[model samples]
Target: MCGIVGILNRYEAQSSSLHTSLRCLHHRGPDDRGAWQDEYLQLGHTRLSILDLSPLGHQPMASEDGRYCISFNGEIYNYLELKQELTTLGHSFNGHSDTEVLLASFAQWSTACLDHLRGMFAFAIWDKETQNLFLGRDRFGEKPLYYWYDKEAFYFASELKALLPLLPTVPELDPVSIDLYFHYQYVPEPRTPLKGIHKLPAAHYLQISREDWKFTPQCYWSLENIPPVTGDPATLIRQELEKSIELVLRSDVPIGVALSGGIDSSAIAALAAPKYRDTLQTFSVGYPGRPAYDERNQAEALAKSLKLPFHDIELTTEALVDFFPSLVAAVDEPIADIAAYGHYSGMQLAASQGVKVMLSGVGGDELFWGYSWVARAARISELKDHYLQAPTWKAQGIRTLRKLAQHPLYQKLGQSKKVPIPIQSWFRPGIDLSQMTLSPPDRAVFYELSPDFVEALTYRPHLFTQSLWEHIPLDNPYCLFPLSPPTTLDIPNQISQTLFQTWLVSNCLSLGDRVSMACSIETRLPLLDKELAELVIGLRKNQPDHCLPAKAWLKSALKGILPNEVLDRPKRGFQPPVQEWMHAVVRENLETLTTGHLVELNILSKSFVQALRDEFSNKGRHTFMLYKAVVLEIWYRQIVLSSQSAVRI
Candidate 1:
């Protein structure tokens, strides 16, 4: 894994400045750096030396003719296999590395070369023969690519900050996106907090031609189009998932797992143990005194169950305070998810233990219906009929819904779904009798969709609106209702699919790729492996619990191999006690920075900052926003307000 930055300039410019931008990403690759320039294009690379640790593996790796050079920022886990295939077809290589395979693959196949790749990647290859620059991200977007385009040039980077300097104009902050940052905790793609820059979405690629100085992005893959599954495919899915996990674990370096004691991580660790059983090492992080949030015991138990060496890091706010200056600087974004504090610490701890690569169970939740919001929405939809009756019911409904909004998960769903009512207001609209338009089965399917999914996941608003219109005419069947609430497993499966293809790609996975790469860590996700994603995606949606609750399939698969106690436990993702930690390091710094900036420069409203902080300190609500505001303010002062160059590493 590494950081890559480049420019396709309209005006002819030297590649020297491009080298400066790549140098700013030195933390991503202190191991090796290279720059290649043509009359109209410049590409730069910062190497992490994951595979072949040789000068041959150093990029900008190029064709022998030097007409085609490339800079890449992620691993092609199947590169070794692809290399064998390419060699069979008479392509010889100088180095035993993925970079050479990639350069050769592109040279042989062009953009179609992506079809042969099966790992996380974001790379740019410039073809001097055609004066075309092609950039592609992995099918799952486990690696990030951000780009900015204008009349003079098109610039791209693994992080936004690296691209900020190439622009002739100062980066503009989009206030609307700031509102989204406040709503979602992290800004969603393809918009960044900056106005002009955009994240290249997963499953997509962009091509820029120097002749016309134009760029266009197109999708090369889609999970949405996977054909439906047939009966008795359970064993097939299990086999496929295991194959994917094995494929992704094929690294030469010492590899470890980030065990959270959850079903997902436990499954990966358990499966991987025998492969590296005696040598396997695991890492977990915890906040002392926060038992409600700590999963260290569960993690340790799993490690013991697998008989692997286990290590735990108990972090204090003080240790984290020392870590954040560089951590924050590394990410170069206001990552409002406080859990990243623990992830950053966990990576540091892993690095210290001499582990260079770490596998995580990140995409599992999105693949399975592990998040509470899915079930919560299901519960709310089930109860809507009971409450959509009397005038008094409506009023009471409003009151209950308002209280539900106070919960962070509900509030987040509220934002994602864009519920019409205030979070505090609970009253859902009573049934509309315009027309009982749909058949019973279809009507039931419509009702199974949560307000959150209806509001958030349905991209074709017109189709969604039409689906809702059909539901308006349903007869009140409360009096003669069946014992169960239409328990088709397919519903949650569809929801899981939506979460993976839409929200997970946009939110968590995207965040992981950018943040970890910014810190120069090559984070591997076992659950997002192409074969695994395809397997899970191909599962019958009708059996929502087919994977069972919290990776039931994983537990069952590892049943005899892993201790039953370890396999049967609940799922607990990396949750950090950031509310308390922020109070220690960020609170005072926030006050000092915001107040001093407001007083000295007289730019922002001091009263607004004070109110934001007061709310954060008193209620711990919107503290996420307060954190974001503080980070943004500090960044503005350092980059936009100060006269000093913002390109420092």
Candidate 2:
């Protein structure tokens, strides 16, 4: 909902640098801006004005005794309840803004206050008395916080752009992060593309004290540690979702829903319609002439049944071409997914209508078993484990069949390769594992880059050398986190947790925040509410297989609330015409890389880049991979090379 930046300098801090950084984040909060400074620290805030629309709501707000001052981003949905409790404990406030309540809560309970919060947030609270700074992110990372630390100073910001200017020079490119970006389309958390910059991971907080000038990030919450709860899961899920939606509706500005034809959005719209009634608005997007990829009609019918207003936007090829660069800039990183364009357009439409907040249903699929591949993989993993526990001869026979099944010729014959039970396909995008060991059920989950590509990339005319690749261990990328392994839970639950922690948190949620804030509108995800997530996780543990029926429990819970047509329809994700759009975009920009910064830096081979563009134009087999390469090149030029004060790559 806003942008926040701060600097803790080892020497004198400048107000000019703080204001300049805030200018870069103006789009995130155009309503108001404020800065608080002292000898050793400075905090700046850009306000979006969703909660309290008065001068009293201004941030860099301080406690009554002037011992604590804070700058915060995101909504704390349960702020009213926290305020009521704090009132009983003798805390008073002049304004009803969540920011005031958050500062008071911290003053009362310190870092333990995080346990009571139930909404998305990333905030920093500075204690003048103790000379300590506390930084925290939401439980699921719905908001982002990036930081750079050194002996000279420590800098933090809501977005990476704000921190770049404070650096003495452009940070060096992190090759490991670059390789991770190529593998996952987006770099994983706790690491950014810049060598010294790091993202504070979800469910964690950092405490920096002036006593020693040392910072240590500690985890405050984790899905792996959630205690089991027993109940009528269907009813509990419905109640929790409604409760979350009601809290998310706490805003001074008009709110709307980003509805799709799918059950997730449809259910949210249905639940929210009665709360706002005729004032509620809904928005959807589709390709201009691609009916197969369009869901406007379906969304319109659902909106009509609820008697709510509906708006649809058509995305043409020309518009996509024009907005491509802006989209890359908004994303801040190269996210190869085309769905980001759809989200960007939808948010732009909503913002144009003067709406400030929009509710989405992003986490439903990850919470429930929405993706068939994940469910199938879980089942396959379970079956393989069961068979492997049999007698030695039986296990050996099964292993022989697994070897044959993994053969390149056999795998090619099948329409879809039966991914090794323990190896998640999502983590190994565009990777070939023929040379790796393939044992049943117990096959190592780690994977290496393809030998051919490695050989080619390590040859002359490349930015990366062979030694860098050799240094990266072939461990599963998921191992990057210290959380418990997915195998600790049931197969279905394991897959759900993996997707939620990695894909949903890193890719989907990051995209939602960036693109929506690009237009200065705030997005709320009801399905990812802390209470709702806890209920869903408890339900999965109680009935793992029962909960794996592609949102079957959710449909049953909302049987009367939503239209049967919407619930029964198969899941068709928001699919854009990426093949056609990418081909056109790539052909148009292909020549840029021939002499552009990426080739000039020797990170990429011009001939290889030419081959990729030509192949995509001729036959669109590697559309996303090629698109990712193009996006990386553009991002590198704009972010790293174009900065007047940046260091040369």
lDDT of 1 at 199: 81
Cα lDDT tens digits, model 1, 1-649, are: 8889988877676434765577667877878999888798888889887788878789888888787888998889888889999999989988898888998998888889988899989999998888899999998777778898888788899876677776666665665454444434456666676778888877888888888877668888766566566544446656766777787777767777888877777778877887778656899988789998899998897788778888888888887676655555555655555566677777777777777678888887766556655543334434433334338967476555556645666544444456654542342221111111122322222322334223322222221123233432223221112222334333344445445544576567765665555545678887888776666666544344532345555555555655777665655577777677766666656667555543344433455556656776686654444565566565555544432364432
Query: Which whole-number lDDT from 0 to 100 does residue 169 have in model 1?
Result: 63
For model 2 the TM-score comes to 0.89
Candidate 2 segments exceeding 4 Å error: 11-16, 383-391, 400-471, 474-491, 617-621, 645-649
TM-score each candidate: 0.79, 0.89
Q: Find the candidate with the highest lDDT and give its number.
A: 2
What are the RMSD figures for all models against the true structure?
9.7, 5.1
User: Candidate 2 on 212-309: residue-level lDDT in tens?
Assistant: 88877899987767767788877898898899989998999989899889999999999999978756799999887799999999999999999998
Query: What RMSD does model 2 have?
Result: 5.1
lDDT (C-alpha) at residue 76 in model 2: 96
**Highest TM-score against the true fold, candidate:** 2
Which 10 consecutive residues of model 1 have the lowest summed lDDT? 429-438
